[model samples]
Target: MKLFPYKPRRYQEEIVQTIFDCLKDRKHLIMEAPAGSGKTICALVACLSFVSENDKGIIYLTRTNSQQKQAIQELKRIAEKLDLKAVSIQGRTNTCLLIDAIPSLKEKNMSNEDVARLCAARKKRSLEAMRGKEEWNRCIFFENFLLIKNELKFDRVVAAEELVEYGRKYKICAYEMNKMLAKKADIIIAPYIYIFDEFLREKFSMLYS
Candidate 1:
């Protein structure tokens, strides 16, 4: 059966077929695909296939916004073909609601006490401000996300480390959920983190879990 709505490139077809076979046999697939290959599409198709009968959906982990968008777009097209549904996740601030969308100016002027005060308002407003309707079929906003994030009110200082720490604490809440889904997902397309992180063997054994 054609796994996706769009025709697959030759390599994409091969990867999809292999992934399909592995999933059917209940075996793990660890591959290294070079750039310019349609790996994202291949993974999405397999995940869609699995989700048809299983409660689990696909998770894709991508480090960059552009890469994540590609997976999302590919999934949108394939979902139409297979009549499937999928969702992408990101941090609260990443969404349109500006859940944590702290502009530079306002943040600069704010004192410690002011920051504390605004954090709650920001989280609550960020949630209440957004539309409940599923306006964008390709992406879905996770409700209660801001509330959950604000509940902790992280106190980190540095920029990159702040995000890194956030990722560590809220392993569930993603900087962008695509990378999580991609690396650990049933059919994921992610970076080197999957293979390089040694602690994963002892900590998160299941790549997707």
Candidate 2:
């Protein structure tokens, strides 16, 4: 699929082929490549190729935002060679505008669960207030999200920066948009905690499975 700009090294090509073979055989692969080995690009190209061939999706679990950015960048490069849709998601704490705007939550050093609870409480209040109103005054971002969700597209790679910019431009919650996008994204990039943390793992499994 002309996955890379330059010719791949023998080892990189081997890794790519091995990944494809493992996927085809329905086997698991554990690979460790040292820094400067272009492991990121190799994995992206190989797995993306597999996904396109099989009409499946890839959930890329990374450790940090920097790693997510790296993966997204490589995916962007690969998108030039193939039609791909990808999205990078961070924890709600990093992407939630409502929680960020609440001083009390910040002062209390609220946990993620706490922040979620408080945010839900606020949203509930807004929803109740708008029960009889002609206009909506809830979280505008979330409101806009619901309004435009049916028209949302997921046919191109969407990095965190672009995701945030889109939400800001449309007044939609970036965090919510990411969740919705994940359902249709060919590649879903997220922190390891999303798949490792007990509570979140179960929740996301239910949502995506």
Candidate 3:
């Protein structure tokens, strides 16, 4: 496939074929390979091949935030050869700017749900303020977002950290930006909690499913 991006390493073609076959047959696959065996790229090529023709999406789950980097790098290479848009998603606890800026929110050690609730309220107020209701406090980061949202693009593979830094520079909420990007992503790279947690998984599924 054009998405492979490089000549196959030893057994790499076999790995790709096995995965493609499993996906085509609607069966489960378990692949065990040594480190540096091109497994990551193999899986990307195989899945992209299927999804490109089938009009589907891919959700690549990693154990930790760090593990997402390698998969994103490999996916970037494949994207150069094929048309694709991808996003690395992270939770609000890592990407919310208000929590860091407000002492009370930061000192309380809020859970993810708490952070989500606060963010939702702030966003609601931001919208309400935009619609001429000036009674509620607005999230400044989201205010900045309204200024820059039209200029934003996610045509390439965007790692979560890189997006976060971009949001920092623009003074927008990275987590909210991620949600907007997720709506258009062909492949989504996220941590396991996105699948293991029922609430988050439902939200994630609604984005790309």
Which prediction has the highest lDDT against the true structure? 3
lDDT of all the models against the reference? 0.50, 0.77, 0.86
Identify the candidate with maximal TM-score. Answer: 3
Off by over 4 Å in 3: 207-209
Poorest stretch of ten by lDDT in candidate 2 = 129-138
Query: How does model 1 fare in lDDT?
Result: 0.50
Local error of candidate 3 at residue 123 (angstroms):
1.3
lDDT of 2 by residue, 79-182 (tens): 88887778887766777766555575566777788767755765665566557654343576666676778887654878766777777676778887777777
TM-score of each: 0.50, 0.86, 0.93
Q: Show the lowest summed lDDT stretch of 10 residues, model 3.
A: 129-138
Q: What is the lDDT of candidate 2?
A: 0.77
Which of candidates 1 and 3 reaches a greater lDDT? 3
Off by over 4 Å in 1: 96-106, 109-209
